[model samples]
Target: MPSPFILSGCSGGGKSSVLDELKDRGFTVVPEAGRRVVADALQTNSNALPWIDPLAFCRACCDLHMQDLAKLPNQERRVFLDRSLIDLFAYLEMKRISVPADLGAALRAVSYAKTVFLTPPWQQIFVNDQERKASFKEAALEYEHLLSSYRSLGYQVTLLPKTSVADRTDMLLNELDQMDA
Candidate 1:
């Protein structure tokens, strides 16, 4: 089985930066599903839908995740994920959106990453990117939710140590190396 690696954390927790580093290290990486779905929804339905069709958005996001999963090459032994199915649960829980049974089961079937790289919220690095909508507080809540979701699902999550980006890169790689030993 490919080593599924999830980079889970708040929006401003340097998740994207981590993705960049991992990609530089020659690991195949999957982008976040939420931003992509939301962007497409905005372009198509200007009047409404996303605000009203929370379930639909969640479904779309789930489908995107599945697509990402399917796109992974079988020959690859390790792949980095920007987020995971657990985020869908977190998004629904935060938005008070109901999850469908099929979606829930699919999420349950998603084998979580052996090592979940989590970057804690850093207010300094946190900025209002074009895609970012949630406030720091809200992101923090979502971050907590993501952590709980993974733990609840029994994943062996590894919180990225508080260090420079380069250090974090080395730390994560070293941790994985140790795990493989």
Candidate 2:
């Protein structure tokens, strides 16, 4: 199976918007695991949130990502994911928390496409929401850490240009097409 293309980067960036456009275009798109984890924890009134318990949050998100990867069934079609296990490693490093052995193993075993798209931090677009609470500064820090992490892992990290959502989406699709060619 072909490796999935991942869209991961600064919080509050336009990653979600591009993913929405991709989904609307009928391509397979995996939502961000962190958002899903937060949504689930909120439903159960659990404190397993990023701000409450980051390690637990990372574990939950890792589990969700693994499950989603196992369930996704496309041998030839392109798949785009908002984030993956790689983010877990970066997050742990950022928090100065040691990664568990199991997580470390998964991070090594799982891989995405060599080229990963990252939404760079845009101050004007950053905002705190119920799910995304990180400030722009924090998001930028996370983005830098994640970029370094991916590069160290041997993926070509592509920064999505700061532009309108439509243009960004078009750029992603066009580049993906070119990559396929």
* Candidate topping lDDT: 2
lDDT of 1 by residue, 1-181 (tens): 6657898888888888878988887888899987788777777873223455767877887899999898888865578888887888887888876778989888767776656877777778888754577789988888888888778777777888666777888888899889889
TM-score of each: 0.90, 0.95
Per-residue lDDT of model 2, residues 1-181, tens digit only: 7989999999988899999999888889998889999999999998879889988999899899999998888668788998989898899899999999989887777768898999999998888888888888999999999999999988888888999988998998888889879
Q: What is the lDDT of residue 162 in candidate 2?
A: 95
- Stretches of model 2 off by over 4 angstroms after superposition: none
Candidate 2: the clashing residue pairs are: none
Question: Candidate 1 regions off by >4 Å?
Answer: 46-52
Overall lDDT per candidate, in order of appearance: 0.79, 0.89
